[model samples]
Target: MDNGKIKHIGVFTSGGDSPGMNAALYGTVKVAEQHGIRVSGILKGYEGMIDGHFIPLESQQLQKTVHRGGTVLKTARSERFMAVDGRQLAFKSLQDNDIDAVVAIGGDGTFKGLIAFSEISKIPFIGIPGTIDNDLAGTDFTLGFDSAINTAIESIDKIKDTAESHNRVFIVEVMGRDSGYIAIHSGLGVGADAILIPESGEDFLQLLKKVKDYRSEDGFIVVVSEGDELGAELVASKIKELNPEVDLRITKLGHVQRGGNPSAFDRMLGIRLGAASVNALMNGERNVMAGILDNQLKFTPFDSVVKQHQLNEELYGLLKTLNT
Candidate 1:
């Protein structure tokens, strides 16, 4: 391969770490190898970009990491990247290293960083959504989301078995900072008596009333997001006030949802997205995200993705009706 014709592609994992990141990296590297291009792994997200923490990513090493959880390339969040000085440093790193393009594996916040980096250096970027939150704007499904929901429901199912045996009222909290995808899906899958999310904005008192009604009729199981406005302790205390004999309890599934080997669905999506990102770069697309649309790979410019896909209304509506 002519050295002058060889392109250097940089890959990084940013924002909240999730499973399947390594798989995406593997796919990108494998596809790039077909074109005689070299790949570099940037550690610790954009902070690594600023500090130049990177290593050569060979196809051999990438193959070893495809089945792994979390990123082989470590991740970090740096507020510095939001500023001019930081962007300058990142651009300087790329120019010095001859990086021709970047494939960013992250959620919304990291995608925003890619947009900023592109604006500063005019470098091409392709994003693969890889967060457990599943809150990324444009994608119908984000990598690690299915795995997370599966992890959460496993816990929920376990809790359900115990709650059923004891005839108890248990509230299991899952992860979802602002989105309800995890809680809603897990609740629906496991037949949760009630599901609470940020979008629902259901009042604590009303929630208590519903729980009380459930207890009166039969035992209850609720799945709530950790970001739910009301804390589990607060809800339990209010329930006690209503009935001193109530056996209401809370189990917060913190970080448990983000762990574990990604299920089959996530691994497949990771492969598809990872390959699609490489195709986007080869096609001269820059500052864009690759996502699955109608079971097909599709590309959307970052600006349009940010504006159009945040907080999907149709899915939210279905979640609401399911709760009812």
Candidate 2:
């Protein structure tokens, strides 16, 4: 697609909300303006795309949004977008608005939606990784991973103080369904006695063994990913059943992990990827995700982006070594 031909661009955040999504909008609106391209902010993702919820954006209005927790345009999952009829409506909306191209801020499901829709439509789409899971393949860091782990770490640290005072074993559950990045990073950051993630393939016995070594510590914290085979409840039950004298408690850090100001790294990453998405479109790139690998911008075609990024075995090893 020629930049001259691409006069209007539509941008939206889909699925889960992340800390840096607003900053991403800032970058897109600002950069697209420089290229003489009009940006239409689509509300509520694919839902808005089908309903024709288009709003013109200006850089000046987005100045203070860089540090915001959630997205300015908002985000949501659309069951309708999964159907052929729903996508047709979305396509008609774009055509009606004369949108030349689009940028999507979201994770696996979002990109997959673009690919599926493309089979029946002609509009080009470029994506920016925005999920907290950090599970997208190719990107070294998704938009909110840093802020999420930082949030998890801060919450875990405070929980430690309480656990230490009561001489209790606290089993904390964090998000990242089927992925361990959040649990691993937060657990390691807070010096958790044990970290249980789905990738570890570790059973409760193995986890108990790790905790045994640090049992005498003032506060015992075990970070378990929601995806872990033995979740916080099971772990708590097993531990309490095995040792009746041990005081144990369970805490599920739910949506709290998904909210907060974008961390320094996340702010930079979000804005950088956002700007890169517009640049990619201007350079005639589409059906790909704007990502950072080795601290440099890279694009992975939707066909190449996998469901899950491989956890760095080396980082996992480091997590184990450092905790010991």
The worst-scoring run of ten residues by lDDT in candidate 2 lies at 208-217
Q: Candidate 1: where is the Cα deviation over 4 Å?
A: 1-6, 203-206, 216-218, 307-318
Q: Tens-digit lDDT track for model 1 on 197-232? A: 776665454566665545443457878887677756
Cα RMSDs, all models: 2.3, 1.9
lDDT by residue for model 2 (154-184), tens:
9999999999998889999999887899998
Predicted structure 2, TM vs. truth: 0.96
The residue pairs in collision within model 1 are: 44-74
- Compute the lDDT of residue 88 as modeled in candidate 2: 97
lDDT values, one for every candidate:
0.81, 0.88
TM-scores for all candidates: the values are 0.92, 0.96
Q: Write out the backbone clash pairs for model 2.
A: none
